[model samples]
Target: MELHRNRGALVLPLVCVLGGAALLLFARDGAVLHRIVGGGGVLLGGVVLAGLLRPFRFAIGADGLTVRLPKLRRLIRWPEIDALALDQPPAEQGRPASPRLLLVPAPGVDLGLPATGHHPRDGRAAVELLDLDRVREKPAEIAAALTRHGGDRFVDVLGLRQAAFDTSDFTVGLRGYQPDRVDALIRRGQDALVWGGTLERQAARSEIERTRAEGLPVAGRGYNTTQVDAALARLSGALTGDPSTDRRPTT
Candidate 1:
């Protein structure tokens, strides 16, 4: 499935290029013609940029993940990915949120997602896997899709609620999960943030298994059962692609 951001903005650039072409062909006045040509060149540049950028999207299919950069499109098979995680760049306090799908490169292998469309090396020493641009869906949704398709190679580095994943927030609430236990699980999830070795990966899977098998303990006036359980189930789905059947809400 191809996940694309809305393409409505492309229309303005298309119109500019078309209108500029018309003026370039017909305008006869010397001074007027110069200005028209200049404007048309600028518009044409925008048109090219928009056209090239139109391919910047996520293409997930049975074979693997294809992340199309502004100038390059990379097709990475499932095994090539080291870790698949999601991040929402922090925004102004009350502004709208923008979430990005981040891919961590494997130990020594490269999956072909380049840092910059213009530069060859991208000037970064670190290995780059892929970054899915222009994701208009909820970050959770994208994460879920990756988990479902990524098979055994994929690891959820961001845990369940990436937008809400943090150290401080999970601290002891009047009515919430055990702080110590939850913290340990969060730490395990963080270990996979950048595709740790086998032990780290095993630990991440272990936490998911434990969370799925045995529910967390609740202290006096602990976190709301429904809320906490629902959150965990969502995380479970994003991690295992087998969300708790009992926990899911039905129509």
Candidate 2:
């Protein structure tokens, strides 16, 4: 997977170049030193701009999953993956709102990130989780891709909920079925909409809204485990004609 944080990395450099040029033209100290400094600023600005346009990669290769930072010429291998953890510590603990992805090394696997003082270094001095972006955006797509190419060697897709909570280690969640299955259920309901099953679609919609209102973690769009299980139980009971077994209310 090749991704780029195009918007984020370009804004500052553009502003700096424009500002520097303006300063060079109007400043009283527009001497040789100022020209030289302005030239250097322009060069650095181009470099930063190029880095933003370039694609960053997350590829599953013959050796393992490699995260490539083309700008930095660095590759992080999966065997070096120690712990795939997430951090959403309470804000009171001084943690940020969104979670981050951390890369922990395995027992013997030597990831070049720590030694280089930049895990998955993309020209940054420190290894930070914010480097990997759009993680939660396409969990199901990522899960399916991993299964197709990586031969199930990647993290288990079903255990993502529990895996999302590690502190010290890097935890990779959404590999679990929570997101994938829930997404499937939601799409199924949406598909029903085409067949004029409006009531069934509404049921799915209500399930989604209720879950969000309840403050339960939703894995993917319209994929709430609690709602799915409850709906499934009700459907099965209905098919069996066992009214006693049905948990849904009678209308």
Mind sharing the TM-score for model 1?
A: 0.42
**Model 1, stretches more than 4 Å misplaced?**
19-50, 53-57, 61-63, 67-75, 90-98, 112-138, 151-251
What would the per-residue lDDT of candidate 2 be over residues 14-86, giving only the tens digit for each residue? 8767766866776565387777677777777877777666665565445545565653344555555543432
RMSD of 2: 15.0
**Estimated TM-score for each candidate:** 0.42, 0.38
What are the RMSD figures for all models against the true structure? 13.8, 15.0
Residues 1-251 of candidate 1: C-alpha lDDT, one tens digit per residue? 67766555456667777666666666667868656675876577686656646656567777788866664577777666655545433333322234445555556765544532211112123333333334456545665777678754444444433332343343335666654455456545543433344455456767867875787876653444555555555443434322222232110
Error of 1 at 68 (Å): 5.7
The C-alpha stretches of model 2 lying farther than 4 A from their native spots are 28-55, 60-63, 70-77, 88-99, 115-130, 133-251
